[model samples]
Target: MPTHYVYLGLGSNVEREIHIDMALSMLEEHIDPLRRSPIYESASIDPRQSPFYNLVVGGSTDLSLAELNAWIKDIELLHGRTSSTQRFIPLDIDILLFDDLAGLHEGIELPRAEILDRAFVLYPLQQLAPHLKHPGLGISFAELWRQLQPGPQLSSVRYPFGVSSFALTVQAGRFPLPGDPCQLAAI
Candidate 1:
């Protein structure tokens, strides 16, 4: 199967650190060299809830979009995420972008709506793939981040996971694509 590049959003307000770490490990097991953005913390969009740590993960995967969506939902359910609960979620994983795909696929909107409306999603996405253009908007994520209206304040922070290298955080320039030959692991 051809590799399909993807970007996924991960967030958790309850057991934030633990859930995020476990989600990272699970994603790495599947997404290969999962490239991540610095985790950003902000007040939960749902005013009744606590703050949330959010980040975006990118990599190439061989699974079809439907298969990938099923896998993500499974992970969320395993962590106690349910439609009936919103005040405290164990984990929430959203597929932000899948290659240059746009519109609805696998019943999930591509380039997730939050990428355009929420600072938490766009900021981390820009860090991970600064030059990647939104498949539908045709604007680079970096530019989108710059144009975003002032909203929730975001602060980048390190998750206190015992293992720092559990996931690769994109610190400078652009992270590698499927085969850009970057020093970072691509598998």
Candidate 2:
């Protein structure tokens, strides 16, 4: 099958660690044609849940946008996620970008602003595809890193779980999400 580039955002709070594990395993088993983004850990925004473990994954696949999204929704359900309960959950997966405005649904959006706002998503994305320009923002990952106020402190924090040794070369400023049209202009 021909492949199209796609970006996915991942998060877990309810049973943070275990949910992430299940999500990853499900991805590998069902979301084939995948390459994972760097994993990031961050505090949960919802008061009802624990801290979240977040990350983005990049890859190309032949599945139609809706088809792929449906599969993901199924995975979320298996992990105990529900559309009605949004405060916090064991797992939350979103389709960040799908091949150049190709996959957006009637209500669905792309290059989620949340990706840029959260350090977890940006840092890991820098590791996985730093050179890839944001669909909306013209700035590269290296450029965004340079623009960040203090820059990501990759050296200071250590993750309890295993991490890939993918190092990003950041240049130090905050960056916009790839799919955001405003951010795409940076490219």
Candidate 3:
């Protein structure tokens, strides 16, 4: 079978510190990634809580879209995720790009529509691989990064996580859950 290009977006606001790492480990184990973006830290758009650590991973995989989605949900459950919270969790792994598919399902949404609204996701995604295009949108992550208004409180750190800093960033704060727009953009 021909491999498909996939980009997965990761976020964790609830159990910030441990969740990102947990999610990353799960992703690494389950997906055959060619590369992963450096983690970016940012203020949460949702008003209720704290900031989030966001990043994108890119790779070619043989798995079909449904298989990948199944794996993503399994990883989230393993990390103590409850989709109901809107509160932050041990992990939130989203399928940002999957062969140009888009829309919501079973009350869940994909491609994270608000992706353009957050500077953190776009910047780090640009840093990770500026050339990669959102197949559905016809725009490159780096291109989108330039158009975004930077948030003063939002900040991004370098990647290949060290224990202390990674821990500190992840445990930061829980922001209100993202709305449909942010969630859909990544799709």
Question: Model 3 residue 117 lDDT?
Answer: 71
The C-alpha local distance difference test score for the whole of candidate 3 amounts to: 0.66
Tens digits of per-residue lDDT, candidate 1, 104-163, equal 887888878989989999998898899999999899999999999998999766554543
lDDT of 2: 0.65
| Models ranked on TM-score | 1, 3, 2
As for TM-score, the candidate ahead, 2 or 3, is: 3
How badly does each model clash, as a count of residue pairs? 0, 18, 23
Model 3 spans > 4 angstroms off = 100-111, 158-187
- Tell me the TM-score of model 3: 0.72
lDDT of 2 at 140: 74
Determine the backbone clash count of candidate 2.
Answer: 18
lDDT of each: 0.84, 0.65, 0.66
Candidate 3 structure quality by residue, lDDT tens digits, 31-72: 676467667677666767576877788777787777878888
- Scored by lDDT, the top model is 1
